[model samples]
Target: MDYTIEIATTDFITTESAVKGGADRIELCSAISEGGLTPSMGHIRKCREMFDLPIFPIIRPRSGDFLYTDEEFDLMMSDVKLCKELGCNGVVIGFLLNDGMIDKVRIETVVRAAYPMEVTFHRAFDRCKDPFIALEELIEAGCQRILTSGQQIKATDGLDLIKQLIEAAGDRIIIMPGSGLNPANIKYVAEATGAREFHGALRSSAESKMEFMLPSFAAIGDYINPAIKENDVREFKKALML
Candidate 1:
């Protein structure tokens, strides 16, 4: 069976590593540590220029809650349009009502805006009051896929729900398992959840190469950076096949 590996990359370097390491697709975003924010237009354009694989940029304006004000939702809409204009394969987005239901109306608006490009509702599905309810709602909203960890912190811990969701979805929508997935656990996640598409950062730390460091200014740069290892991404894809 063929499985798809979508590597979540935060910057140019890690994106390059993921491509070199053989990611099937790219979930391009910024501030992944902040749970992923919409990447800058320049970043989007550059990635589109450099990579041949599918690129789906996240359309999040901020990090805190999934609830968005009208203004914030408008911002998200603009970002979605921009991604389309830049020739993205798709865009990942999510919004929730205060009552903890899928914001289907707003989500539908985004789906329309995205047009020919596909939409994958991001992990905000995990925060909804109900997963099954939200799953049906997302399908009704016209999303092609939902990237979730089965409402858990990690796919490994959420296998039961993930499996149940897969059964519930049953080809209606792609339930792509994500969050805390890596090369080490890829095989188990695939086996346990029966998920065809997986997502992860697959990153390891790399130290910055600056020879001179000022005592007080040393805090400016993260001397140790989180980066994708080409081999780890390769192994992650390999594990899915096993």
Candidate 2:
């Protein structure tokens, strides 16, 4: 069976690492620790120019909740437009109503705005009121894929639902499992869920190289840098083949 690996890259450096590590696609973002946000134009432009891989920049405007105010939604629209203009392969997005239902009307509008670029409704699907209902709605909205953890914290823990979702999705859309997945368990997820694509940060961290540091700066939590390791990314792909 063929498998595709998507690496969530937080910046140009991590993006490079993912590519070198053989990522089949890139989910470009900023502030991945906050569960990903829209990356800057510079990051988008440079990656589009340099990489031969598909780059889908996440179109999220903030950290918490899939529900957004009108102003925030506008920002997301602008970001989506910018990604297309910069030649990104696609955009990742999600929106939810207060009751945890997908905001289908708004999502459809965003899909229209995205035009030729494909859209993958992000994990906000997991936060929705119903998985099966949202799955059909996303398909109707023209999303090419849905990145989900099957409404659980980790895709592994949600294998039963993930498998069921795969069965339910059929050929209507691609269901990619993500969150807390790594090289070690990717094969298991693939076999269990019968999914062809997978997503992960696959990150490793290193302390700052700076020799001089302010002692008080430690309070802000900036000492370590997290990034997708090339070997780790390679291992994820390798595991799928094995």
Candidate 3:
């Protein structure tokens, strides 16, 4: 079976590590703690220069719900255009109506603006009222893939539903299982869901390099740095072989 592992990267450091560890592609984003927001133009350009793998930058304007305001939608469009200008392979995006359905009109607009660049609907599909209905909408909107956890917190927890989605999707659109995937469960999720593409972040906690400790003030809340470990990435790829 032909399969590819996409690493959800937060910065250039992680990007370089993932590439070295054999990541086929990267979903470039910022604030991965908030479920991934759009990365800066500089980051995109730098990654493009640094890696030979495909880079699909997320187009989310902020770190909140999928229901975006008009201004936010405009900002997302600008980011899409910028991705195209920077020669990105694709753009990851999603939008939903207040009624908990796919925003077909707006999504179509964004897809049209994306043009030759591929579009992968993000986990915002999990928030929709109906997965099957939303799947059809995304396929109609010209999306190449849908990254979802099958309406659950983690892909392993939603294995059954993900299997159904993959069967339903067939050859029309790629149903990629993501969210909370790791080396421990990647093999199971891939075998169960029968999905060819998987998305995950092989992250680990790294202690800050500060010898002097600040007792009172904290710069980044608890000072715990969550970074992608090259060993973890290699393990994840190994799991795919199993």
- In angstroms, the error of model 2 at 128 is 0.8
User: Lowest summed-lDDT stretch of 10 residues in model 2?
Assistant: 218-227
Report residue 122 deviation for candidate 3 (angstroms).
Answer: 0.4
Candidate 3, overall lDDT?
Answer: 0.91
* Residue 239, candidate 1: alpha-carbon lDDT: 80
In model 1, what are the clashing residue pairs, if there are any?
none
Q: Tens digit of lDDT per residue, candidate 2, span 1-242?
A: 88888999998989999999899999999999899999889989999999999999999988999989999999889998998898888999999999999999999999999989999999999999999999999999999999999999999999999999899999999999999998789999999989999999987776788887787885575777776679999888999888
Where does candidate 3 have its weakest 10-residue lDDT segment?
215-224
Ranking the candidates on TM-score from highest down gives 1, 2, 3
Candidate 3 local lDDT, 83-165, one digit each (tens): 99999999999999999999999889988999898999999999999999999899999999999998998888899989999
Over 155-191, each residue of candidate 1 has an lDDT whose tens digit, in order, gives 7888999999999999899999998998789889888
